[model samples]
Target: MRPDFAASSNPDSITDSSTWEAELNLGFTQRGDKTVLVRREHRGPLTVQRPFYPEGEVCHVYLLHPPGGVVAGDHLTIVATVENDAQALITTPAAGKFYRSGGGEAQQTVNLKVAENASLEWLPQETIVYEGAQLNSSMNIDLAEHGRFIGWEILALGRPAAGEGFDSGAATLNWRISRIGRLVYMERLRLDAEAFQARWGLFGHSACGTLFVYPASSLHLAAVQELIGDEANRGVTLIEGLLICRGLDSRADLLKGFFERVWGLVRGDIVGKEVCAPRIWAT
Candidate 1:
């Protein structure tokens, strides 16, 4: 007999849920010799993709490995810091998928900090939420003066390929981006299965992603619009050098592909890279 799969009122209370945390600190200083320092600490069983830039340069690190793949009551935390003049790019090996839990809820928290004139990219792999799963996630970022950061989060509510179309599950996401202790942008999205499937909400789509580009400039604005022109299903906004791009899709891969394109454009124009495909991303 198959087990019952239904939404529970208290998903966070399940006893079997797992927990995990990972922290990485990157520092760069010009002390007669230009060198980069990396300190990584892992407290639990999490696999990391390792940070890799072109030509094997360590721009940033990508950490993976979920404590326990999003079972009911699971909690996960990821903390990262980049010191002054440090440049890093972080990305997951693949999409982070959350399976349905029998009982409680699953939650994840991410915190990122970039010092003055430092550049950081928090481009994790996309996240897919299965039916009957309840998830709440938040991402908070702090940047200093002249700090540059690029971040992206993609969420897929259900497996549309298997005939699942967000008919189940609940997700709440909160994100805030700030620089020099000043708020730049803040937004939240709370979606239930029904609301997510509404023609107007996700417009019956199963996947969506948000890309944030900070400390916006006029050139960046024009470049972003040129890159995202007339994508009917996506939305774009500019706020204080922060470009926000949101896209809705029924296929998970579509979201990933879209993000890759956006990343390439932004990196080339803003980050001074002709090709931003990190070596680890291709691996």
Candidate 2:
């Protein structure tokens, strides 16, 4: 007689039923020459309220991922608002990891808005994609007149340790930046494991990342070009004061280190040291 497979259910199967969801909002306001803000929301499954204060001119925010992370059909949203003349920096406590989707898809959306003459630095930790996971992410930024903004995204396709490198699954990323309801920068990246892994495609290196700055001046453009020269075979584009840097590498740590170096250069030149780094990164 054949074994009755339906009679036995594994413990792992029972635990996979629970899904994860996280909704967070961070608000910043200017106080004299300093920017003060409070993080009022929950982190993943943990229901705790945390507040952050700026050490100098910069304020930091940190995000912690749930224990198991997003399952199929999970949705996560993050919204940030910077008041007039305020400056703030946002970062995640650690890199976000997306596990394989059991049956459905997972999505994440980020929205950022800056008031007139305000500045915002979006420096998320990083994102790692696991095998068989489907992820869709979008970033939208609205800038006020004379507002300064800088941000970066570093994505690793798969677990290099296990020799898994985006061999399957799908990912789509979109970015849009606007000024006073007028579009300034728009870009979209779509990739499939097999298609993108080809020699000439995106995943040939296993990891890719982008760094962008808005309202680039002539001097800034020259300086950025000089800084990126022969660093990693990067490409720089300028559109209406926006400077964009696109880079690809075979290692995840290399991409992260590159962002740190480039961010330091750009921040020192454009935003100065008075601004605070994201708090999550400090820990």
Candidate 3:
């Protein structure tokens, strides 16, 4: 299991009576050509549904947050490990909500580790940030030689369709990926409500998203490009063998659909088999 997140700069953050800190750790292993969940530990409201095998060899798990949403000073951490030759795909049943903060920030940290010849897919639903909310989110991925990973993140600044925009809030995001003990990708995004609404910045867009694929080989670059044609408010790039796809939109549904298509394509190629959406996604 991964270590807990470092203590917050404000020592009182977790000590507040209203604050809630949750943690969950999971490990997967291969059992005679079938991926199975071998370990799981949790504290607080984080948990996972029973493992399902939709593709025979791949295990599908759905992470659950029973509280359904996060409030001020809430801290959530998740860590997952996949052993050699095992494959696992994890997703959420619904969008994660970050409610308005009362001068305190909510934090979420995730770490994933994959051993040699292993494959892992981290595909959670979108995250919704309410006005006046302060959110800090980070993801760290470590992969051994020949390991593979695919993941995506979507964030909505506010409820745009409902006429609620991010008039006041702060958002910080960090993503890091390392392969065989060498860092290959790192990105950080910080947004202040005022500047984020500027034309030169987010341009009043209420939602932004990114899809990341690691270890994409030259042989698949052309195919990847063909799948992602030129589109407004969207771009695709390859950095240090990581394929990054980014987009900005007013609605989360648009970005969600876009990411799903790319996920299907990439998974098919990497796994050498067609994949279907997990049954839980429809519920």
Candidate 4:
């Protein structure tokens, strides 16, 4: 039987709490030729679905938030560990929503560890920051020798299609990537409504996205160049062993699709497995 979300079956059970603190820890290991999710634990609204082996050897999991969104005073933390030679892919079923905060800030932190010869793909959907929402998000990845990671983060500020704009509130992002206990990539970003207006900042774009990959070899870099195609809003760069891609667009969905195309191409070349959209992504 497939494992499902562990949070309260009733989504409303978490909304009444003055402050929400949730944590999920997952561990994956390889058994013979197939990777499996061997450990899963949760403390609050955070949970994960059963592992799916669409690629035969790669384990796929969907992270879940029963409350459907993060409000003020909500803190969520996720920690995932992949054992040696194990391969895992993690994603979300839907876009994460950061609701308007009356006065407090919502926080989320993700920590991923990949053992030697292991691979991890972090491909959560876009994050929507509603008007007046204050949010802080951080992600840290630690890799051992020969470990690999590919992931992306997309943020949409305000609901432009609905006539709402990010007139107020603040959002901060921190990301750190390391291998063998040494830092390879790190970034810090602070975006407020006022900063969003500057041409040098988000470039007046309501939505921005970034994709990062580790162990980017010459062949992988060439593959990325071929994938660039006619994407004028996107740029790719290689730093150390990491390949960084960034894009800005008024439509978050369109931007995500563009990135997805690139992901398919590069992922196939580097991981030796063609990109297969998660079943949940289509639903």
Candidate 5:
């Protein structure tokens, strides 16, 4: 069955349309002493600002969705490839918003490719999904031998500060991580109204997140645990060198902050450098 998006003569144009279909493709390659964005392709509202090198040589980019929010019948895609020996970090200017939908599902897909001896960091801010919204999101990462990656996806289920809870609709998330063509970790989670209010589920928490770090050691897990030990709803574990961290909170900012702290603790081990906070984050 086909998705119900209206036919458009121009694939990149959203003129007079109620729904949007957008995609962005980014490629980074090492040149001389620096990593550079060599490829950037986009359609519709999805695009990126010029690459920033606040730390020098390491390319940092901010994704932009000009419409500011996604609603029913919208589809978005983001793909990034880091060539051999290159390093890049990708983030968004602010939290993404998936507004309430009347019926159809809004979809977002992300694909990340890290080549041999390369490093890529995916650290977008939290996504805010409003009440009555239907969202389906997926992220897949493929890494070659000697490649490294650290990434996280934080989600805010509803506008907690606005007294809105995700009482209706659903969001499904899927993640796949593979190395050298071998699939290692795969997961799928579906959240609906029942799960939102259930003690076994979120138990009224409005925000949740998962952070993944490749090439991690048991020591890294211990260090992260030391940061999360005081929080009852935060946890970390190591599986086949992949360190997975999870957290839940009533506010999205809190959950995002916790992940940032965890990232700061392990970034040096993962990337051989300490965290250089993105300047756009403070603005």
Candidate 6:
């Protein structure tokens, strides 16, 4: 089988020697009832906007990737830490794009830590992977006892509305979650051309997503199930104290909307605060 996707980025891909390597690190600590960005370091094209306090002390931030899209040989790393009693919510202003690879793979990694009694929300927009793209992405999260988290990741295989499908290319996604110094959950997914079309795999869905909320309840699971009642291609479950939700669809926008609805339903239970969408989402 052959992949039916683009051969390179909108322009040509950069050679491995000339590829961009970017890294961003941020630290947040509680200061007088507010979480302040106490430490920041960025190299290359990655940076963040000033923090916003739309819902009181919760620090809301939007990560920015100035280069807009990634191609072969690009690597990005992000690390964020929230100190005890601090609270932070992070997101991206726009969807990330992984263009078709000329050769080597593009990679992105995220590391997050929440200290005891702290809260962190990782809610980036979905990622768009063009045909022939080779991407390796992973997220690692560590939470101390009593720390709370609500986050989601969405992947769009191709531009379905534009008549494109993931007929070629490769993607590997991984997630690691640890609480109280013990690993609680881990997942790995490898999707390729065959898996994209297989009935036992994506079954031709162009978009898929997962949402996780730590320290959840049966009632919360019930609430999410109640909201998703009878909806095909959507499911929810409670594992230990984590609530996990999954969705699949043909359009990325639709899947993202569905995840947003679920986020609204379960946020209060997970974070003790009602769903206050980051204002950046509006534009």
List residue ranges in candidate 2 displaced over 4 A: 1-16, 38-55, 274-283
* Candidate 1 local lDDT, 74-111, one digit each (tens): 56777778777667777776667566766567778888
lDDT of 6 by residue, 58-172 (tens): 9999999877778788899999999999999999998898887877899999999999989999999989988888999999999999999999999999877677788889889
- Score each candidate by Cα lDDT: 0.70, 0.72, 0.83, 0.85, 0.89, 0.88
Q: How many steric overlaps are in each model, in order? A: 6, 3, 0, 0, 0, 1
* C-alpha lDDT (0 to 100) for residue 78 of candidate 1: 73
TM-score for each model: 0.84, 0.86, 0.91, 0.91, 0.93, 0.94
Pairs of residues clashing in candidate 4:
none
Ranking by lDDT: 5, 6, 4, 3, 2, 1
Residue 183 deviation, candidate 6, in Å?
0.7
Q: Which 10 consecutive residues of model 1 have the lowest summed lDDT?
A: 1-10
Q: List per-candidate RMSD values in Å.
A: 5.1, 5.9, 5.7, 4.4, 5.3, 4.1
Worst 10 residues of 6 by lDDT: 1-10
Per-residue CA lDDT of model 4 for 1-283, tens digit only, reads 1112133342223332366799999999999989989999999988998888887999999999976788779899999999999989999999998877777899999999999989999999999988788899999999997998889999999888888888898899999999999999899998898777788777668889999988887676777677776867778888987899888999888888977887886776456689988888889
lDDT score, candidate 2: 0.72
lDDT of 3 by residue, 1-283 (tens): 2212122232213322366799999999999979999999999989999999888989999999886677778899999999999999999998887777778889999999999989899989899987777899999999998888989999998887667788898889999999999999888898778756787668888888998887776655666577667767777788778888888887888888888887776787665557678887788
Supply the global lDDT for candidate 5: 0.89
Q: Which stretches of candidate 3 lie over 4 Å from their true place?
A: 1-17
Which ranking of candidates, highest TM-score first? 6, 5, 4, 3, 2, 1
Pick by TM-score: 2 or 4, better one:
4
Q: Which residue runs does candidate 4 get wrong by more than 4 Å?
A: 1-17
For candidate 3, which ten residues in a row score worst on lDDT? 3-12
Query: Lowest-lDDT window of 10 residues in candidate 5?
Result: 8-17
Best by lDDT: 5
